[model samples]
Target: MFNKIVLENGLRIVTENIPYVKSVSIGIWIEIGSRFENQSNNGISHFIEHMLFKGTENRTAKQIAESIDSVGGQLNAFTSKEFTCFYAKVLDEHLPLAVDVLADMIFNSKFNEEDIIKEKNVVFEEINMYEDSPEDLVHDLICQTMFDGHPLAYPILGSSSILEKINKKNVLDYYKQYYTPNNTVISIAGNFDTDKTIELIYKYFSNWIPVKKEKDEQCPPMFYRRIMGKTKNTEQLHLCLGMKGVPQGTNEMYHLMVLNNIFGGSMSSRLFQKIREERGLAYSIYSYPSSYKDTGMFTIYVGLNPNYVSTVLQLITEEIDKIKNGGMTSDEIYKSKEQLKGNYILGLESTSSRMSSMGKSELLHGKIYRPKEILEMIDSVQREDVENIAKEVLDFNRLNISFVGDINNNQIESNFKKIIG
Candidate 1:
């Protein structure tokens, strides 16, 4: 069960109490990320995530880390396409300390000029590390190709050139604009008294004033049918195929999940069986859906020998065609639903996972679906739903391709044209 409270300043706090557990997980979710940035400040959200850990007014970076470690607790943060989270896991008795430390960091993080300069170098190295990983780089390429001119295509780790020009003034201005009570949600799970937990949250967060600013209208990204390649000297070609998919918080998302599980989302999935298990064409091949506020993308990725690209692509197309031509069976759908249910239920065993799920749900959709409700939604998915979603999302004509390796651009273009046509 989940309990929620909304502060006078619009800050929302959500919690789930698990009496059997001795630990608690808490997360502060902010609904701002790379999508909120423009071309000039592309990586500022992630940058700010790093700065928050550097130091706070009352605590040095070492003390902040030691404060959690001394109590046998864990603390970390991450930035994604749609949001950012700073979280901690600690014993139930230490919940108040966790809250105080996190609040102090969020409220008093010193964005010193020297720290900014030092962190910029660190970010530059991080970008360099990303550049060296072609497998990871190819996924970013697919996004850049699929959403040709949208902010959704922007890299979460902005380029070195642009990041170099971002100074303290830019960082503070961007942080001030987006880091407000209304745009934030604090989610906690595991053993705690709900009444007392609410009081503790109020102590640290109730005074935060909501920022008055006009919200930016988000434009849905236009999916492009194009091929993009990066020439790199690597042993295997990393390729990604992208197409349109449904947005977040929709029944169609469940339908897509069922379809993905049968198609390429699992080890026993059709793509894995055909390409790797049978033919030995690739070591890694899988498909996933990336859903956002207003739009989404379904992507298929495979790393294979450059010479076998044509064979692997044809096999992938065959599998997609089968799904499009009513090849999925009732058994597959049933098993997938069971797999999803098991995965969801097992994930709840962890306090961190529960905290994350509640935070992301309330922060994005403004509602948290109970376990019973979610299981019912999954069980309600019928054959027609999966089949309809397959036909709608598996349009080869609109496919966009992105690849990285020693393969020639002309070769990739020729293979794509032949297989797709």
Candidate 2:
């Protein structure tokens, strides 16, 4: 179970007490990321995430890392399309240490001018590294093609040209605008006294004044039929087919998950079994749904030899059509529901997963459901629900196709036109 308390400053502290565990996981989730950024300062959120660990008022870069390492604790952070999280996992006895260290990084980071200059090179190399990996780069291209002219299409890593001009002042200014107590959630889970943990967090974060700033209101990204092909010297063709999907917290999302699982989410899924196991058309192929605050995307990725691209796309298209037209069997629906429930339960067994779940639920939805509630929701999904969602979200005509490999543009255009038309 989880409990939450909203502080006077508008910060929320949510915790789950797991008596059986000896470790606790804590995270600070900020409800802003690359999507909130405009074109000029696109990657600053990710950049600031890195700068937070460089040095604080009292701890040097080395000391901050050593403080956690010396105690056998894990400390890390990640930036996503709509949010950023700085988290740490440590022994329950060291909960205070974990909280203090994270607080320091969040509140006292220097964002030094010299460090900004050096980290820009590091981020640039990181961008180049992704460009060299076609499989990874293709996913970004898919989003670019789907959301042609929106901020959502901007790469989370920003662009080399933009980063080159960003200075310390720019990063600090952006950080101040978004990183407020009201805009953040502190989540902790594991064996600990709830009152004590809350007190510790309050001690570290209470002094900060909450700010009132207007959040950027973004219109949902419109989807269109687009085919983007980038010719590169690669061994296999990396292709992604995607369409616009439901937003977070929508009722249809549950049906969409079940639909995706039966279609391509697991090894027993239609795409994996038919494409990889049965016909040996591709070594990697699967489908996933990405839901954000206002909108989402449903995408399928495949990496196969250039000779197999045509066959693979055809098979994938056939599988989707089959699911949409005929719907999945009762057995498939039962198994998928069971698999989803079991995985959701097993995932919460870890302190880290529980902490993350609590944080995201509160931040994204403004409410968190108990495991029983979630399982019930999953069990309530019927075959018709899945079929209805599939029909609404899956359309061959209104889809985007992105490919990265040694494939000519004319070749892609011809093949896609034949199938989509």
Most accurate candidate by lDDT: 1
- Please give, for residues 1-421, the per-residue lDDT of candidate 1 as tens digits: 6898899899999999999999999999999899888899899999999999899999998999999999999999999989999999999999999999999989999999999999999999999999999989999999889888888889999899999999999999998988999999999999999999999999999989899887789789877689998999999999999999999999999999999999999998999999999999999999999899888999999999999999999999999999999999999999999999999999999999999999999999999989999999999999999999999999987799999999877999899889877
Worst 10 residues of 1 by lDDT: 215-224
lDDT computed for candidate 1: 0.94
Candidate 1 differs from the real structure by a C-alpha RMSD in angstroms, to one decimal, of 0.8
CA lDDT of every candidate:
0.94, 0.90
lDDT of 2 by residue, 1-421 (tens): 6889999999999999999999999999999888888889988899999899999989999999999999999999999888999999999999999998999999999888888888888899999998999988999999889888888888888889898888878888899988999999999999999988888888999887999988868889888899886899989999999998899887788889999899999999999999999998888999999998889999999999988877887888888888889757999999999999999989988999999988998998899888888888899999989999998889877789999999987898888877767
Per-candidate TM vs. native? 0.99, 0.98
Q: Poorest 10 consecutive residues of model 2 by lDDT?
A: 412-421
Candidate 1 wrongly placed segments (more than 4 Å)? none
Error of 2 at 121 (Å): 1.6
Give the runs in model 2 whose Cα sits over 4 Å from its true position.
none
